[model samples]
Target: MVKTPLFKSLPSRDRTAAKKLVAPAVIGIWIVILFPLLYALYVSFHDWILSQGKIGEVNFSNYITVLKDPLLLNAAKNTILLTVSVVVLEIAIGFGLALLLNNKRIRLRNLYLFILLVPMLMPPITVGLIWRLLLHPDLGIINYMLSLVGLPQPIWLADPVLAMITIIIVDVWHETSFIILVLLAGLTSLPDEMYEAAMIDGASAWQKFKFVTLPLMAPTILVATIIRMIAALKTYDLVYILTRGGPGISTETISYYIYKVFFVFLDMGKSSAMAFILLAIIILMTLILMRVMRTAEQ
Candidate 1:
């Protein structure tokens, strides 16, 4: 039995050179990504940075304090509300839009897609500013339109309930395009024969959709949900721009709360703890989503 010439010709020096070339790049990436996470973890267990600055002592007091803080609890509630509401709305709207556009009969599909995706592609700051202007009570376009229609103008950002609604609207508007793109990909990838067979069997539109479209698109939908959930959970830029976590903290999410703790309040220890806690929640949710998706796939 003769070994391959390629294997026989391979030299120890080549392997040594390849290792030396790759090692530094791998270490550089680890330092860039892992180092901040490690430092944040270390800081999360410390007491407030005292007069000694970097010489401060370490403890679990910060985590304990945050766990007991009423503000943190409220922030947690608001975060969950914002994430779930926006994600659900985005998925529904996105699915509807994807289904509509998937039909070849729809005229100017490219134009429709472009229009739908513009909001998602806009800069977060720009989106926030545009929404702020539109939602403004006194001199905004929305109010003006309402007045023209003999309706009372609603204070979109000033009331707590309205503020939450405004946040969800903005999130859904920006994120629905992503869902549409993902689902549309799935729709286009499906085998048309299944739908043809369903049609031949005299299946109703609803029945075909329920029995054929959904099962085939389940994996794509799961992936899109995960992506949207992660983005919604970490939503910060639009919230910061539109509300600044304002209207009496009604829109204050965990990310915004963490920002306030670290930057506005200058409490690094507790902020680090909160950040780690949020990280843990995100990890758990991602794992759950992955497991459910795998089950569905099988």
Candidate 2:
């Protein structure tokens, strides 16, 4: 028999094969994600006005301009309002609905869940377009119905205040399903023995949920909230398709403003800077949430 090696060479060969298998994905990520990010960061430091041919001029003046812009400030404020409102409403409404659906006694629960999830399944653009048609001030079925009922048919996306509220409602409608699905899965995965013990202890329905369920489910809720908040901070497509930051910019978000700066205003440098700023904000939120999650887990 041949002398056996102390460490197998096959393991090294396997590692090589595994690296070969993962190489494409790594390369693709570099090309698709890392390269663009690096290029964008480089661009942020230079003035690159497409229209005026002011390319490759290094400066941080645009970043200062962006920081001081009142419109950007307004967009930031609007984003905060929209993010907070939608997250709160969606979490409250979604968790409530999840609790209802999680109950075995609810009739046609599957059907209801399917219907409720329809909006979320639709693309954001499609949702925006559908709601636009439905909420059209003059020609929409909603306004027509309101007229029949002798009520004021407000312009959903035209009025400044209403535009913001409409965006929030539309966002809630589209996003609540996600919250419900996450929370419902969390509810389902919880151990039944704990609840059985609680029942043995003479805990009421509300008491069981408050004392046992909430503590166990807190982490899941925090995770879902963080994911939603990150997405919320990056809101652009809905605002784009729905309002285009119009009706006097009441619904303008930082993402939308950055788009306008890059594409509409032809200011690539400032847009890149704004994008990084937004990234920093997102990273901050993520870091804070991650810390909270770790603490909660412990």
For candidate 1, list the clashing residue pairs, or say none.
none
**Candidate 1 per-residue lDDT over residues 1-298, each given as its tens digit:** 8975666565889888879999998899889978888988888888665344662577867788888988888888998899889888988999999999999999999899889987777887888898889878887899999999999898888888888889888888777888998899899999999999999999999999999999999889999999888878888898799888888888898999999988887777888999988988899989999999999999
For candidate 2, the lDDT comes to 0.91
Model 1 C-alpha RMSD to native: 3.9
Q: lDDT for every model?
A: 0.87, 0.91
Candidate 1 accuracy as TM-score: 0.91
- Candidate 1, superposed: residue stretches over 4 Å from native: 1-14, 17-21, 50-52
lDDT of 2 by residue, 1-298 (tens): 7986765556978889989999999999999999999999888989898898857788868778888989889989998898889999999999999999989899999999888887877899999998999998888999999999999988788789999999999999899999999999999999999999999999999999899989998998998999999999999989999999989888899999999989998988999999998898889988998999998899
Q: Could you tell me the lDDT of residue 137 within candidate 1?
A: 88
lDDT of 2 at 124: 96
Which residue pairs of candidate 2 clash? none
